[model samples]
Target: MLVILDLNDNNKLRIDMKKNKSSITLSSLCGIIIALSTSCSVMSKEYKTILIHGLQPQQLISASATNVEADGASYWSSYWGQVSDERIDWPSYERIEGKIATDWIWPKLKQFSEANLCDSGCVLVTHSTGDLVARYIIDNQANWLRNAGLQPLNIVATFDIAGAGGGSELADIAVSALTGAASWSFVIDQALTWWLGSDVTEAVGVLHDLKVNNARKISPVPDDRAPRLRFVADGDDFFGATKLFLKGSDDGVVASHSSCGASRVDSFGSCSRHIASDGQVGHQGNGVSGFMPNHYPMLMSDNYSHNSIRNAGHKGKVTVANYAANVGGKQVSFQTYDETTGHWFWKKQYRFVADSNRLSASELIYDAIP
Candidate 1:
């Protein structure tokens, strides 16, 4: 079992992450991009911590994947820890439903929730396999967090960056090889390790759970999710490398269709999964992205890729739109951008104006970049 890192129990991990923070930034200096709160004295409602899992680092000496909280604490702190308040954590890579996870492992999650989460709730910023672990806990641990004194805090913000909600082709191959379910000749046992690229380790990698059919089983989302759910996924990233295993568009590790959480489509162009955004004010409900029949879905785009979408708090490609509506006069305009190419189709956009207010509380936009 692997415990990643956090503020309370991970003092060592914190130090390690601080040391490597600059390296992570240098590695993805050009990474594409994409939070909140308020108060009079700016009192924090609850512990606003960032929780991350799934994509941890590999242990160099053991040829195994290191527990984020144990071995490569620096890697996580260096990367995601910088994304939010002050920290995150490590989780066991054991099969999520297995006793290893149920008995000794997942309790750590419950403990983490009880310790950090409060009225403000915590923001879940997940990526790739992190989505799978978070989905299970978010839907299943509602009562647990509530019992821990989290409150109607049942609702909270979730940011899925390059979410592998659908599943990954690499996982399919790994699962087949491990279980001997599919043709072993296609990818022998040793070859599967090669595909792993160094994940072979003492702990289970949770790849079986990431299989397509298995992953799709994670729907209908429970009704107890927050109103501000956001998913940022792309179809392509490592074109030169993904082609070897991925048959369709992928974000190096996840398929585009899977990453977007787009499960169903109709002849009429309507989709069961990718629900279009309901608009600004209409976002105060369970149905985020218009597809909340079961699971809390997200607004998606195909113009971007995975791996390169991690947020580092940079303003390189950010756009801020502020507005207030009262009688609301009329103004309308349109702009287009090809997200996949990372280029806007238009240089500028025009917005018509209506009547509004001044020194408003704040603004929250849930759109393509949400």
Candidate 2:
């Protein structure tokens, strides 16, 4: 279970690392131990790509969530079961906590990258809230990186899938449904279960941040000078078949407006991803109130997982374009992906951020860096 990446420092990852001293004991971790490059022998190694999971717990995601819904073709997460160089011990089934991001994730990331990376930096592959968490780090690089014993990290790219860009209406539903005025809908319950798999009492912080107005305060800036941020959105409503559209497009989980940051010019209040803080029950505002970005980040072949049955509802296969193919004549590890095998390459490229034309992780990680 060794996941590795081998890109140069051309990509940048903007992460959020707000300091906090909250001590949560995750009493219900379900006894899952997500190992991160555990080598018994104490030795230094070079690596390229790193893995960061999103909101869904690792135990039930990818290999596990598919069990919830399968049309028969195939279903795999972009980062599920894929070996990686670095693995963040994101709570397998709990909503994110700022302390985890700052106390554990930030330090571990810097330590791992510094100890294992070559000149070629690593590629950050994130999903859901993981994308937002990383953006928080970028938003506060000085304290998170330098104070933690390193200069700014040189990330190559970031891959965001169904990111909670402007938060979700579902958050509100998850909070009130169990006791909301409306009758308890089985569909909403199921979707919320899959989302956090925990009680509302345990989700106060997550729910607070998922609020539209609250989420906007910590949302990514319009433009960041770091990595190339590439976004992928899902179309099919996998969770409870709920067509809860934010602005216009939705994937049962996240609205397309929140994912692509587009399709909200004329649609205005009706089609925006923004959900007014105060609205009538069952009434989401025009979706334009909060931050409305105009850029739609995507891959050349169009990265929309769960849109097709062939790649499974949630899995995608991308043939890494090797700019250095002639020299190596093969897929460079850390910078490439083999669709047929669903594995990331791990060869060290010693890729550095050349001042000539070095761009941020294109430019994902959050697509905010450059």
The best candidate by lDDT is 1
Q: Write the per-residue lDDT of candidate 1 for residues 142-221, one digit (tens) a residue.
A: 66556766533332555556666666677777666556566666434444444455445332546667777777676346
lDDT of 2 at 207: 59
Computed on alpha carbons, the lDDT of every model, listed in order, comes to 0.43, 0.41
Question: What does the lDDT read for residue 92 in candidate 2?
Answer: 32
Return the TM-score for each candidate structure.
0.56, 0.52
* Global Cα RMSD, each model: 12.8, 17.3
lDDT (Cα, tens digit) per residue for candidate 2, span 102-207: 5557666677546745245555555555556656654565456667666665554554555665666676576566446445677766676655554433334455
- Model 1 segments more than 4 A misplaced: 1-47, 57-65, 86-92, 99-109, 112-116, 145-155, 183-195, 198-205, 227-230, 233-239, 244-247, 265-305, 311-370
Clash count, one per candidate: 12, 62
